[model samples]
Target: MTRARTLPAASHLEARLGLEMGQYSCAGRKAINEDAIGIRAPDGPLLTTKGVAAVIADGVSSAEAGREASQSCVTGFLSDYFSTPETWTVRHSVQQILTALNRWLYRSGQGLPDARRGFITTMSALVLKSQQAHLFHIGDSRIYLLRDGRLEQLTRDHTVPVGDGHRYLARALGLDIHLEADYRNLALERGDLFLLTTDGVHDVLGAAQLAELLVNAGDDLAATCRTLCDTALRAGSDDNLSCQLLRVSSLPTPEIDDVVGRLTQLRFPPPLAAGNVLDGFRIERELHASPRSQVYLVRDVQSGERFCMKTPSDNFSDDPAYIERFVLESWIGSRINSPYVARVVDPGRPRTCLYYLSEYVDGMTLAQWMREHPRPAVEEALYLVCQIARGLRALHRRETLHQDLKPDNILIDASGQVKIIDFGSCSVASIAEIATPLVRDSALGTASYAAPEYTVGRKPDPRADLFSLAVITYELLTGTAPFEGKLERCRSQRDFLATRYTPSYRINPRVPHWMDGALRKALRFHPERRHGDVSEFAHELQHPNPAYLEYHQRPLMDRKPLLAWQLIAAALAVAELVTLALLVG
Candidate 1:
């Protein structure tokens, strides 16, 4: 069998996202080699998204089906881990699989006629996702790391020390009805090496000896593995011998220039006229255009289906950041499957230029709708707010943030369904893990709707979206902003605190006082002061809370002393002006 394999670099941008692996197993003096190892290095999307996985298992020598148990655990974990949902985090997917595998092993052991002769094994697995390594371990098997010319054990040996330097296995698959596996995450650096070994190898070779052998072997991991096992056997290791080696050759950098260069290599499609056709799609009309991108209404020539096509703007042709964002927008839209969010369409045929298609929302933007209905009824405004909140919740659940949430980015279809659009400024948690140089200092959303925390250089959270929603809700109900657009001018926390909210009832008396309180809480300058979640904010809009009512009922003089004093000063000035005019006459 091939004992060594090396995964070449994935991409120029991710040169470090590759691994070299090797394994060697020997029975030594034992009758059979009850040890197994598996490695999976997939290509394309799986390689880019999930990276690589390696597993090593050592079966209990006392068990009758030890070899079968070890082989099954190793093979089962590698196959099942990749089959898990791509949306699941690495820890979640691996843990779920390990739990099921343990249950199966325990049940199989129970069916054995001899209680002591059951299927049992110790396993350790590693998953290299992005720039981090996730490790899962059980029983006495070990995983070690060699970095900066030093070797350190990464897994704890699950054994109880006894007299005369003897130890007993305390944890192993099928040893108990329940299993508790150890998990850890380590940041990966280029040229780092990792070693996985069963007790037969680790117990015989000390850390110094192992590190020396690995360093001497250099890039030949297969030779290193063979040498380690041979040394273990020479040191009187009489059990099944197994060892695996892995090296991180490269990792992906967070720079956007490479991604942008590849995406923009193709020229942007020329400005299309109503009768123009490109790539099987006929342009009906231009929908929108900005410095960042252009959107046009189009129809498939063959199927006659209407769609919206978006292409990067020539104005930003040299701006790598803008180009990267434009491409990511389409990528995000395609992955997210939500009715409340705009849908990205896959153009059946290949395209000659750089552009993407999306479902056409045959309705006006929320900004236009707000212009027509300056002061919508409370119920109508709440309905729209709830729909928008539901859309935001969908993005949040997928570990994505629609950072630029504003009236212009919201589309209200003809059927009155709200769909959030424009993912140019959106942030995806998974993508962020890939290491990028992009700075988060600039606020992604419009100043008027952006959360105060964003202006102060704080990371935007779910509450930030809630804050933007509240601004929209307040405007819908009162034809005016809660803070008279002061939030946009706030440069710091102090400026945000000094900005006072204008009462919704003062602008539109029809707006219930309790509803104003809900909006105020959601739009709080401090994220912590806002609603815990979007659902809570939506609930509060429809339900009247006694606390909000009491607060809203406070006398104007006490509630807003600055406004009260301004009114009093104005009245005195008017009286003085009248007296002076009368005396002069």
Candidate 2:
């Protein structure tokens, strides 16, 4: 593979962060150079998503296909690692690609007449994502870190001493069917330097000498790599020589003020009106508007297709926290693909304003629908709730959480299809790992529909969303909230514990006893007491579970002794009044 001499300069906010890299390889007293190196510094979204990757491989001198093995390992890893799903974490993406590459190399080496002639190589890779350096290693290649003028080895040699000043590789890419690569993460700072070398370079130069040479090299990294290779060859090394140097020039500031300043720099377009055109899209009418954002019904002037364009409100233009959340909402919409979720559209032309587009749906919000229906049947409520659960499952699978789940966030189309919308409050697992100065709290979701744990500052889980779903279901059947406004009044754990759930059957006698039991279990005070998963909750709603039925069958006295005693006293007072009236007659 050909190496790129110059990478594109970082733009906008990313301009504050970049990397410098240098590499060199040569045949040192060997017939052929079997060592290979590769580096990739991507631009745009890839710079933040995949980051930069550098790899070095050393082929076994005794193998006939050693050169091919080393080249393939370096090129394949760099190419495939960038093509992985952006939603995946850095550790997951690299490990999966390495496993597949190892299997292919192992199969190609099988059935060889001599084991020494098989394809084999050692590999070490470094990936810089956000503010962390991820390292993957195998075999005898070495990786080192030079920080604060101190050099330290970060990888262990995968070799075993045999006899008489000779050591054979105990683990390599093609040596066995099962491959175990060492993986670790290190915190990166602005001036940190990383060095990657084959056995040839490290075997010759001691730690103190290598550090002194790197320090003296100053600003010229390419010359430093060339010097390291030449010094190793002159020291009587008999293997292929290779070395790579990478230095962090800067790191992106993740402070809330910085992020907000970058995002809010784009001026919001002047108040749009019908018949106005902007960025190839013609405005038809206004769909919705609020203090946070405005949604407009627009048509692509070229194709005449309708779409919904959403833009941030100027009222919050100076609020950094709100601006950051607005930008993340669009990113989340693009990554998730599901029928039950609204699709985010990419404009064929460059956007002139700070707005995003989505496929327009002629539908009403779930809140509006509930107001019209007032009392939906059990079967109808189950069907709608089940569709919402499916949408939640898609987010959970991608390690995302819809922290703001409520009737207002769901839409029902004319054809009766359900789609979840409004991701401004969602929390993404992979994005959370990135170093940022924003302090995340549990105040994102609405108070009435939000789970009790969130109000008390507990970490949210899938069960929290389930609690919101159960609240919606109960309201759909009985037109009343289960907590009777207690969730909105709660300010602490004590308030949540003091709240009690009113049976759904009491509000609407049409609700079956078993179904009420299912709702009660899903609305438990503690997350652990709720259903294990959304699917489990959906199943219980359709098929009556004996356990839920048994719990519901318990007498009113067992359920609430105080309420039962109050009712008993009222009954006795009425009976005494009747006996006195009979005596007076």
Candidate 3:
């Protein structure tokens, strides 16, 4: 009979493989030790299968609510993941944790008593399973892998672009309703060391210095962690400093008998090459490759058919959260059928690697189409736009809102058929959820095309969709958009308001006047004034002279004395003509 590696049968062994890790925070030069870390094992059994590990968070000092939010996020994720079933995979575990955390953070930031409101933070965590190391993170706090005497950063920072010099994070732990974390899985080799730390340590030390310390720090794992913190402090670091280190030997591995089988079966193969066949499909072209996943053009090997395949980013095989989202998008794409929407033929679940098997499309994005063909014929443009309206009508009937309805999200096919894509930002409509105050003002959609109501706390509606379409229509007819100047140079909204269009007849006099008026009505600034439904808007395109109410309330006319005199003169002339006729009789 084979023997299992049970949790230390002896008290010392239990204390050995299952070590309790912790932290020491130093203010360094900051006003507050806003940095934090948390750990919990409510029951010894909770750590029985795979011992629990530590999580650390470093809040940005600039934001007011960073401290509490970061701390809460770490504690909340650990609490939720641990209580869940052991049968759950790492990716699923992290997905639920992030979703729950985002829901809590978004809610916490909205109402009063928001201790960590508006605060952004960088986070890094380590979860040990048998001998494998699982790292979960977002923002800049990093995970470094030490193997064969080399150090590698496991988590990529989500900061904005700089000459490698931008400061703020591009993506954060709790910035939006949807939050995602990057994760990595690595085998624990004996003498292999793992270091997790805030920027305080990395911002000051070079890779060479980090390797030197791990080599000389000897057998004391805690002391090695302390040395890193001390080194950064000595280097005159000016931010909160924190670090956690783990050195492993003969790491535990799951026994075959101990593992539970899942209904879903998912296996990952290394990056694929052109001509490789998967699930009966042959790979054609590679599309996108980010740290989390890769996308490829795949065709049915048997039928010589093609579609898209998306797999986890190289470092995220152990990430349960990413897999969940990948699966969700896959499912959503398959069920939604609209010529304007990207059609999905496959939706992934827990058992399968996430992929999008979509109908292969050949066309230019609206942005590209407009740029290349600056001025398409009016009739042709309207025909193309009407197609978009009809598709949107179908989408509305399904009760779906394309939260991200920007130019890039629209594609124009060879037939001039418009296809809408990228439903990543979509949300189901619900009375209570829509009423939430914070989501109303956070600017969920793209700027420039976004409605003014989005800048304020207003729930999105179908009219929001109209506002975007109007922006597109205005640009298609006119060479420029309503807001044409550089964002930095445009001082106020008033400067960009669509008051007067360059009448298509004026620009291209051959264009009919009726078409211009109808287009103007569709591009109304206020939603109420715009066509109520896409079908109505499309119909108006055919009958450009249809009697329609103005899209927006005309600015109250400023009637002055000069204008009143002209009107009075005209009325007097009409009366004079009537008197002359009576005198002649």
Candidate 4:
């Protein structure tokens, strides 16, 4: 028979916070307090003056490592990442911290005994920033936002099924023998009661029990939390119990401002002709077309320098949001300096129709080049991914994410060099809110190359861009993507791969082993297992093993069109000879 561990005093937890922030955790009849709760106040300046906070972890006793791992997760994040000094956008900061926690717990659990091996816990953390509730969770820990005497469960649980293994979560942290997490965010309202609890509460008590306590708890949140623990104990919960009661003491209410006006009926006539001087440059001719922007080839009259001018699409001339985004991109784009990035020489004035110029790249986009040359040599493909990675590293260093990284967004110069373009989806590190919503309902990017996370509703990050680049690189190397081809249409992202796998040697018997391995890792469904940054990907590409070149360079079969035609002719001649002999007989 197993002797149970002793539970800690409820007072240790109860005494930490009084009325200002009420919280409680109980080990029940268990010997250890595997279940944990974390409650914190905004320690520094608020982006919207609304406090940022969270409650986390309901340790699964069956998973013995749950208690410490979960506790470490909450405390670890609070100590290392909270109140970031740099002006990082809320979304970026949240995801980055969660990612760190995931890796730490995952690495810790590796190689332990089966009883303690990969010990895991459910997590539900809420950050009340900018009057909005940013929620991050995994496994079964619960988050409830209560208002008007009602409670709302704000998180989805990851578990395995009981009867048919159906209730089982398809995804969870530290469960599938791998470490990763998923999160959701929402807007918050004052007078909201946020509940974070263990499965003991959610599993044993019905909605009526939860509703009754919350409604009666009233303003005495600490008393309400205690009652919840008592109710779970009375219900004879077989597992540990814990609950955190949070009231949105204050919800940020932003002051109203002027809305951007509609576009005017007047269309922007064609820009000045070539040699027509304006500002410090002379206009030449239009370089390309875009839905909301136009580019022109121009030369600096003073320095005789040539550059490409970017102006907003004639349709959005009046949309201030569009104008603002355009101008913001110009400022961000000018600082990019990598061989793979289209050079942005200057961020010109935004007053007259919102325009900026970049160095005129004399090369075709990767998209156009791909159309002309369906398959690229192995070396060329490797070189391209390296360059793209280098460019991405520059952007990452600047604390920016490309948000959109695809073949069409990359240009190939006269020299087999690659250049990344299109900063319209670029975002600064300080802004937590993502502005793009078009892709949520419909497809957001070029379907063939969009990352699975991007295809779904997840916010774009550097890893997302890496996924796209990996797909594009795969397509370039094998003359096809790992999924969604004309011959076999991949129905979903999961279809292309189940577990991580290197591209099959069968595709191009010539593909280098190391190159294939790198691509496969980049395309891993979980972000935590993949390379941390673009710089890592670049380093691997540059140092590809010699075996990779040797395998790919060997002649598998004569692919030359002339050889195919010769083979065809030889077959026809043999057929004629056989037919002639039959006639004579």
Clashes of each: 6, 0, 20, 11
Could you give candidate 4's per-residue lDDT for residues 108-197 as a string of tens digits? 677677734465677887766544567877888888777888777777777767795336555445665454566677765656777888
lDDT score, residue 534, model 2?
83
lDDT of 2 by residue, 1-585 (tens): 223233332322233455778888988898889999988888777776678899999988888778888999999999999987666678888888888888888778875777556889999999988888999999999999998899999999999999998999988887777899999998899888899999999999999989998877566787789899899888888888999999887776655555556776667777899999989899999989988899999999999999999988989766666766777787888888999888888888877778889889899999999999999887898899999988888887666789889999999999879999998889876676566665544478998999888888888888998999999999998888878977988999999888878889899898878888889989988899999988889888889898767766889798778989999999999999999999999
Note the Cα lDDT for every prediction shown: 0.83, 0.84, 0.63, 0.66
Per-residue lDDT of candidate 3, residues 1-585 (tens digit): 111122351111122243334345667887778787665433343454334556778877766778887778777777777765443445556667777776776666666455444646677778765455778887888878788888887888777766766577777766777787787777667556677788888889888999898778565566667778888989989888887765554444333222211102455556689987666677888875766567687877666666667666657555443444454455456546677777877423232343567776677788988898788887777877887787676666545566667778787878877888765555433111111111122345776666555654467666677667767776776667754423223234563363444555566665566666666666555567777777776777677453432422232233245666777898899999999999999
Error of 2 at 94 (Å): 2.7
TM-score of each: 0.79, 0.77, 0.43, 0.48
Task: Give the winner by TM-score.
Answer: 1
lDDT assessment of candidate 4: 0.66
User: Which has the higher TM-score value, candidate number 1 or candidate number 4?
Assistant: 1
Worst 10 residues of 2 by lDDT: 1-10
**Residue 390 in candidate 2, Cα distance off native in Å:** 3.6
TM-score between model 2 and native: 0.77
The number of the candidate with the highest lDDT is 2
Error of 4 at 41 (Å): 21
RMSD of 3: 18.6
